[model samples]
Target chain A: MRSVFRVVENHRESDWTHTIFFDREIESTPGQFMMVWLPRLGEKPFTLSYLNAVTVKKAGAFTEKLAALEPGDEIGLRGPLGQGYPPLKRPALIGGGVGIAELRLLALASEEPSFVLGGRTADEILFYEEFRELGPVHVATEDGALGHKGLVTELLPVEADSYAVCGPERMMAACLPKLPAERTYFAVERYMKCAVGLCGQCTCSGWRVCTDGPIFPASTVAQMDDFGKRRRSKSGRWEAV
Target chain B: MIPLPRIDPPLINASGILSYPEVFTAFESAGACLGGYVTKSVGPREKPGNENPVVVYPPEGAVLNSLALPTQSAEDWERDLEEIKLKNAKLIVSVYGGDAGEFAGVTRRMSRFGDAIEVNLGCPNKEPGEQTIMESIGQNPALSAEVIERVRDETDKPVIAKLSPNSDYLAVAESCMNAGADALGCGNTLGPGLAVDIRSRAAILAGTTGGISGPALKPINLRMTYEAYARFRCPIVAYGGIETWEDAVEYILAGAGVLGIGTAFMRKSTHEAAALTRDIWEGIQEYLDGEPMSALIGAAHRAAEGGDSHA
Candidate 1:
């Protein structure tokens, strides 16, 4: 519980998502997450879309409450925790839906990153303009409301020196075989309790997701037996991913 | 004193932390200096435990937890043990039950998998009815002793009764020793403490209450360990808010045979946890100046009695 209380310096909302900018800069790399706390509402891990901000999708009760918060609201943040994406030259970044939140910082830091973003509809494809401003952007939607009408994995750049994929595990798993395992990095998500190494709740194939990684090389990700199959529920039971 | 498992550095990840077999491998691979790893306390049956917000930090800088021992079943652990391997660490299995019979059943099933059986008699965060049962078992000397006897009947391995700091610890220690417990785990977290979020008008944790641990708990746990050691002279595994080598030495000096670290791990990764362990071990070695660590156990008592309490 090493949390630093900070005021929500600014907040912007768009299409069921809230991007909150805290009062100050956080010393963290792209893949690391902060355990955002809202007093009695509890804490949940969120990857920073920027060094000083977190983009949260209205997914559950916690996020729902967080969505209702304003700029002056006080919140607590613990860590730019867990391992982040390794620095790569011209890495192709692939994200699906809200999963793009984790790769935004990497895109900001990389020299020339190729972006492949997918969503159910064009509206679901977030940060389209933001990512295009950074580098070349590829877009896909299930309903053909955007760029290409298909999955994000179909548009992954095989020519990039490396790859970083985030979002649904199903998409990442499908994208796995296409990229060289040694060169591809994947940001994983799981039900995290402590957001630290203490609780084994976020364990994926014995690796503590909170500490060992929220981001791992595809080589390591390939070795995980439960990768796209199952995940531990809040009650410690295994449920389908 | 009856023989205890060989824990070279005599430090371990406290129960309720590092439960998964794979996580154990992760820590071992990272060179965690702990002599062993304690599995999360398992019961006769699997329990999912409380909902989210299981652990929290109060404004006091201490941790409050109501994990409620979310555990896999003994059967599951047996399956895990069959496949698990650790090159440099020993395994100490912790077990809990609603009563002596339930406790014994799991111990009987898990006995062969571990070097020792840590009877969790001090967990404070349980479902409504179960909480009272656990409290009574930890606080009442007779009931506590009965649980130990039942567990001892099931396993030949050393039985370490983890006592509750909120209770009459010395009485509980004596009762447990008389009942044939080989060792004592000093205590569990302090209060089923409450930390309210004024803004939300409710408790911060989903469980409403959680046991307290951290720097704030050290003195209470140290005193309990010292008192228990002075009275029973039993091998004691001391844990309470230990974060550094100085804290480690303090417990050793106070008669702790081993140390259980929990809250500190919340802030460190495996590599850092390993470093902390090595740091604590090295600090103890420097303080010992070549003397065996055992020589320092209860040394504080000896010093207070004006005996030769040489470092």
Candidate 2:
């Protein structure tokens, strides 16, 4: 059942991060995403930062419009789409930049996980307080304004048996060598339309990221040669990300 | 009655668009109102496909893609098809092979799971060989007929030939009709076009060339459907840039028995697609009033001939 829901709450998390809470009750799990539509404005997929809520960053044309949206505004939403992060008993949740939005909910849902959140600057770090409530939080900012001053992967405990990781492809790629391929579950992001596996735009290797993953086993990620180095733009051209 | 199958709405999700089994229920619930869903083209073996930038959308509501027909083997697709349940919608499994024997082999194995078998004769990005199979088979009447005849021998279920607009599609359609094809899926995508980013001075897609689809391809597809209808007796499944109710009506008027929606589905949500279907149905009803649905099927051709040509 898809429907148009009114914005109940919109919060500015940082200079660029904004969270919008919808009136709609959509059942979803961590690592899944929603196709947010603003009618004539257009539609794009956003990872769920929390249940029925999307944390957006002002990046492109659609996100710029999404940033300006306020309470009482109506936006069309469909999903809780794609594969989600599975529940893990003891896991490490690692996120980088806006990719942290995909991990926030998973951190809360997990039993007691170590959260490694990374950003370029302290101001860009997201959901720190919320993640802190669930488990120990490790923060890393490139500027050294936050906890550990380096890549979040630097803060990731090398000893964790299993992991849930999300972030820019490079960040995930950096973490890949550290985590056991059989134990890590990576939530990948890609350029998508339909977000339903039909468009073929979000394909990584033979896998449709929209369906086969947004969440992929470490073994699957290990198989994709283009995982960290290349990504397709809206124009469908592959360029170095 | 659209002739190919017993679907009420006469609209279908185009091949290679949305083939995920878990999402079909959402599309149906969202009002996609499709009569059938065509799976992506499956072949004899697994193809990893081309690298990044497989699909791109131009400003004209058109999408260019050089996906290189990436697919799992027919055996894998057959297994996948078993899990997909679309309630009332028919499953039209699309298959592709480098040669007629492979086509027959794949069709024979996949036919039991589908309401129909659609032979993909339109992919534009086949690697350059002594002869590219799609062009060699699709453009030549004898070769096209032979391919269809082989597939026809494999299945009693309806056989649909998905023809390419790049070739002499009308001849292909005519040959397919004569070769025992029950229907024709007209106009795959248009042009093996290239897009280069001026900033990087590099090709947009990893493949460097892809088929152009969307509204920009609609005019070409519409004309192809019109010609196929005028030339052949088989049902025509028209696709290209069908995005609106008016677009749907235009295809029907131009002689498309079943309409395929692709790029438009990319732009609109499932709810919007459903609404569009309802609106098109109502619009068709209003346009027909008490006239039989058949009256509008080839009305343009009848008008062009100044009489009922079929009669």
Q: Model 2, B1-311: lDDT tens per residue? A: 12466766788878877654434555676666777888777778776566544555556576787767766666666666786768888888888887888888888889888788888888886532323455667767788888899999998888888898899887787788888998888878887788765434566566677888888999998988888887774588899887777888899999988888777755344455567667766777677788876779978877878875553
Docking class of 1: medium
User: Candidate 1 — which pairs collide?
Assistant: none
For chain B alone, what TM-score does every candidate structure achieve against the true structure?
Answer: 0.96, 0.92
Docking class of 2: incorrect
Deviation from native of the Cα of residue B270 in model 2, angstroms: 3.5
Model 1 segments more than 4 A misplaced:
A1-27, A38-41, A50-53, A68-76, A86-88, A180-183, A219-226, B58-61, B127-134, B307-311
> Best by lDDT, which number?
1
The 10 consecutive residues of candidate 2 chain B with the worst lDDT sum are: B126-135
Give the per-residue lDDT of model 1 (tens digit) for B1-311. 45678898889988888777777887788888888889888788878887657777766768998888887767777877787788878889999898999999999999998899999999889753466434769989999999999999999999999999989888888899999899999889888898776654667777788988899899999999889888888899999998988999899989999998888887576678788888988888898999988899988988877965532
- Compared with the true structure, what per-residue lDDT tens digits does model 2 show for residues A1-241? 2356888898999989899988866778888788776654556788878676898999978898888789988776767777887777678888889888888778778777878889999877787887787777889999999898888888855456579888888899999988888889998878775465556556565356776678988997998766887664543335576
TM-score of each: 0.90, 0.63
Total clashes in model 1, counting residue pairs 3 or more apart in sequence or in different chains: 0
Write candidate 1's Cα lDDT for A1-241 as tens digits: 4455555654544678877777788889889888887775678889998788888889889888877777678777878789998898898899998898788889988889988899898877778888888888889899999999998888865588888999999998889889998889999899888777888888888778898889998988988888998877765556798
